[model samples]
Target: MELYRSHVLVCAGAGCISSDCQAVKKSLLDSINRLKLDKEVKVVETGCMGPCDQGPVMVVYPEGVFYRRLKPADAVEIAEEHLLKGRVVKHLIYQTPETGSAALTFEQIDFFNKQTRIALRNTGIINPESVEEYIARNGYQALGRVLSKMTPEEVIDLVKKSGLRGRGGAGFPTGLKWEFSARAQGKPKYVVCNADEGDPGAFMDRSILEGDPHSVLEAMAICGYATGAGQGYVYVRAEYPLAVQRLNLAIRKAREYGLLGENIFGTGFGFDVEIRVGAGAFVCGEETALLASIEGRRGEPRPKPPFPAQGGLWGKPTVINNVETWANIPPIILNGADWFAGIGTEKSKGTKVFALAGKVNNTGLVEVPMGTTLREIIFDIGGGIPNGKKFKAAQTGGPSGGCIPAKHLDVPVDYESLTELGAIMGSGGLIIMDEDTCMVDLARFFVEFVQDESCGKCSPCRIGTRRMLEILDRITKGRGRDGDIELLEELGRGIKAGALCGLGQTAPNPVLSTIRHFREEYEAHIYQHRCPAGVCKALTVYVIDEEKCTGCGRCAVVCPAGAVSGVKKQPHHIDPEKCLKCGTCMEKCKFQAIHTL
Candidate 1:
C-alpha cells in the first residue's frame, strides 16, 4: 500500500453536493497536482458528515482538523497553510456556539457527539467506490464469517435473539421476517432491498446507499444465505442517480472480487444482485407493491394473507427489508446478538437514523440509540429551536407519522412508545416545528401531501385522506363548522382501520396525532376564527399600529398588495380591504408596528 502524508476527506453527500462540495473536491485535486504533491496527498469524496448547517465540509485526517463552509477560493489557503505548512486554518475551524472555542475534530462537535453510528459506521470515513477501502473497515468480514462458519438457521437464531426490529417504519422483527421466508417451502427464493425512499424530509436510505452501499449489499447477501435465496434485487428510486450509480459500481466490484455472483469466498453459496429502478411512487415502498413493480407490473399494492414470505416475486417466497434494515444486518452478525441488543431499548434494539429537519438549529442526519429522548434530540443534539423561538411540536414518520407536542418532548423515542402516541417510527423523519408554525396549517400540509401521493388503490386511504384534507383546508381557511373536529377524528379512525396497506393505514396520522395533542389549536381556528400562529392567510389580518409605526415607508414599499398608505415620518395605516394578508407588511415593518390578528 502506498502511504500518503495527508488525506483530505470531502463530503460528497446530496446536501454537500448541493452546497458545491464537488467544487471543493475538484479544487483540492487540482491544487494537489499543481503543487506537485499528488503522490504525497490523497483526496477522497465521502458521505455526509452530519452538521449540514456547516456544509461544504472537509476534514483533514492524521491531525483531524475540521473545516466548515469551504469555498473554492479557500482551498488554496487550506492547501498552503494546513497541508503544506502543517499549520491549522484557524478561521475555517468549527467553533463551539457557546464558548467560541475551536472544535479541532469532527467528534468534538455536538452534532456528531450524541450520534451512535452503527448503520452509518463506514459512511464519511471510507471512499465508497473502492472495495479495498471498505475491506479496510471490516466490510466483508461478517459475510466471510457467516459463509465460512455459521449455518443459515444459526444466523437466523442469532438475529432473532438480537431484537433488531426494522428501521423502515413498521418496526417488524427482521429475524422473524427472514424466518418466515426460510421456513416457507419454495425453490429459488429471493431477497429484496427497498430503497425507494419517498418521504419528504427522509434521506436515511439515500445516505446509506451513497455512503456505504457495500453494507446493504453484504447484509442482503447475508439475508439471502440465511433464507436460502440465491437471487437478490435492490429496488431504488430513479431520482437517486448518485445512489444508483454507486450501488451499480459496488455490485460490479463485489462480483469481480468473488464477494457477489456464484460461489463467494469458496463457500459454494451462489448469490447475485440486480438493480430495479422505481418510478418514484410513494406506494411502492410497501413490500407487495415493490414486488409488483420489480416484476414489470403496475406499482399497486395487493392484499396480504399470502404475505410475501408465502407468495412473492415471480410466485415464490421472498424476504424483503428496507435499506437501513439491511445495513444493520452485517453489524449484528459481526458484533454478537447480545452486543447489538445491549445498545438500544428493550423490544426496540439498535440505533435509528433520523433525518432531522425543519426549524432546528443543526439540521441533518442523526443516528442515536433507540431510547434517546426527543428532548435530547431536539434541545441537546439539535441545538434547540432556531431564532429563539419556542419548540411547539415535532412531526415524526413523515406524512404518515404524528405531530408530538412540546409536552411529549421528553418522550423516549422507541417503536412501541411512539406508536402508543399515535405515531410510527416511519423512516425516521424528525421535522421540528416552532411557535411560528400553525398546527392546523401543519396538519393540512401533510394531509395534502399524502392525499396527492395516495395510489387510490384502497377507498379508505384514497377517499378518507382527501376528505380529511378538505376539512383541514376548510378549517385553515376559516370555513370550518362546529362538528368538524369530531368528523376528522371519526374519519381518521375509519381510515386507519380500513386501509389496505401501511400507507393508507397511517395516512391520517398527522391529523389524528395533531388533534390528539393540539386539539385546542384546531378549535381556535374553527370557533375563535383565528390562526394562533397567524400562518393561515384567511384567518390573519395585518395592521400597522400608528403609535409604533415610524412611517419609514419600508412596509409600504415592500407590500405587494399596496395596502400601506402614509407619508414619510408619519404613522402608516394599512387598508384592510386591499390587504391580501401576505404578511409582507409585518416582515418589512422595522418598528414592530405591524401586528397579525
Candidate 2:
C-alpha cells in the first residue's frame, strides 16, 4: 500500500460524467504528474457526490476541501496550488446557494449537513470497484458475523425488530417479507435486488449501484443467508450503463474474494449473486414484472397473493428488495437493528433518499429522515424555490405520485402521510414546483408518462389511463368541458381500483392530487378558458401594449413565423392567425409590452 500526503476524490457518477468529470479527472492527473506530485497526491475517481447539479465535483481529503462545477481548466490550480503547495483553493470550494458562502469541508455544506445518509452511506466515499475499500468501511462484517454467529431466524427477527420497511415504495416490512419467504416451502429460493429504477428525475438506485455496489452485494448475500437462498439476482435497468459496469466489476471482485459463490466464509453456507439487466421498462419497477423481465419474458406484471415471498422468479419463494432497500441491509446487520430503527418515524424507519429536481435552488440528491417535513427539505436544505418564486407544489413518487401544494408544506414525509395525501412514497422522486408552474400541465405531463409506460396488461390501466390522459390533454389544449373534472375523477378512481398492478393503481395520483389541491386551475381551464400561470399556450393570447412597445423589431427578427410587424420607431403588431403561440416574440420583447390574455 502506498501512503499519500493528499487524496483527490473526483466524482465519476453518471451526472458528473455527462458534465465531463472524466475530462476533469484526466486534467487533474496530467497536472499532478506535470507538477511531480503523482507520488504524493493521488486522484481517486469515486461515485456520485450528493450535490449532482454542482458537478463535476471533488473533495480533497485530509483538508476535506470541497469543489463543485469544476472544468478541466480548474484542475491545474487544484493540482499545483492545493495538492503540491498546501494551499486551500478558496474559489474551488462548495458554497451554499442561498448565502453564496463557501464551505471548505463536507460537514459545512448545508445540503449534506441536513441529510442523514443511510442507504447512500458509502456512495461518493469509497471506490466502488475496489473490494478492499469496501472492506475498509466494515462492508461485509455484517454478513461475516451473520454466517459465523447467527442463524437465519435470528437475522430475520433482528431485521423485523428494526422496523426497516421497504424503501422502494408501499412500505412493506422488509423482515416480515423475508420471514414469509423463509417459511414458505420451496426447493430453490432466490434473493433479488430491484435495480430497475425508472422514475423520472430519480437516480437514487443508480447512484448507490455506481458508488457503493458492494454494499448492495453484501446486503443481498446477507438476505440469501436469512432467506435460505443460495442465489441472488439484481434486476437493474439496461439504460444505466455505468451502474451496470460497476455492478459487474463488483460482482467479479466479490466472487474472486470469496464473498460470493459457494461455501462462503468457510462456514459451509453457499450463496451467490448475478446481474440481470432489464430493457428499460418502467413497469418493471414492479417486482413481479421485474421477475418476468429477468426470466427473459415480456416485462408484464402478474396478480399477487403468492406475492414474491410465496412465489417469485419461476414459482419459487423469493425476497425482492430494491437497490436502496438492499443498500440498507448490511448496515442494519452490523450496527444492530435498534440503531437502524431509531433513525426515522415510528412507522417509517430510517432515511429516505430523494432526487430533488425541478425549480428548487439546490437541485440534487437528498437523503433525510423519513419524517422530515417538506418545508425543511424545500427551504432550509433545497435553498427554497429558485429565482424568488413562491413554492407552489411538489411532486413525490414520480409519475405515480401526487402533487403537494404549499398548504401541506409542513406535512411530515413518510409512507403513511404521503399515501394519505394521495401520493405513494415511491422510489423517492421529489420534484419541486414554483409559482409559475401550471399544475394542470404538470398533471398532464405525469399522466402522459404513465400512459406511455403502462404495460397494457389490464384494461383498466391500458385503456383507463389513456382516456384520462385524453381528457387532460384536451383540457391543456383549451378544449375542456365543464364535466371534464368529474370525468377525470371518475376515471382516476376506476383505474386506481381496477388496475392489475401498482403501475396502473397509482397512475392517476398526479391528476387526482392536482385537482384536490389546485381545483381552481382546472376550473379556470374549463370555465374561464384561461391558464392562470400562462403555461398553456393555446389558452394564451399574446398582445403588445402600443404605449410600452419600443418597435425595435427584435421580436419580428426572432419570430420563426414572422407574425410580428412594425415600423423602425413605432409600436409593433402581432398577426393572430400566423402566431404559433410559441412565445418567442414575448420572450424577445424588451419593452415589457407583451401581455397574455
lDDT of 1 by residue, 280-358 (tens): 9998998899999999998889998899988899889998889999989888999899999998898889899999999
The C-alpha lDDT values of all candidates are 0.90, 0.91
Please give each candidate's TM-score.
0.98, 0.97
Candidate 2 Cα deviation (angstroms), residue 150:
1.0
lDDT of 2 at 273: 85
Q: Candidate 2, residues 253-360: lDDT per residue as tens digits?
A: 999999999889899988888888888889999999999888989989999887999899899999999989988888888888889889989999999999999999
Residue 319, candidate 1: Cα error in Å is 0.7
Q: Over 4 Å off in model 2, which ranges?
A: 545-551, 565-573
Each model's backbone clash number: 0, 0
- Give the backbone clash total of model 1: 0
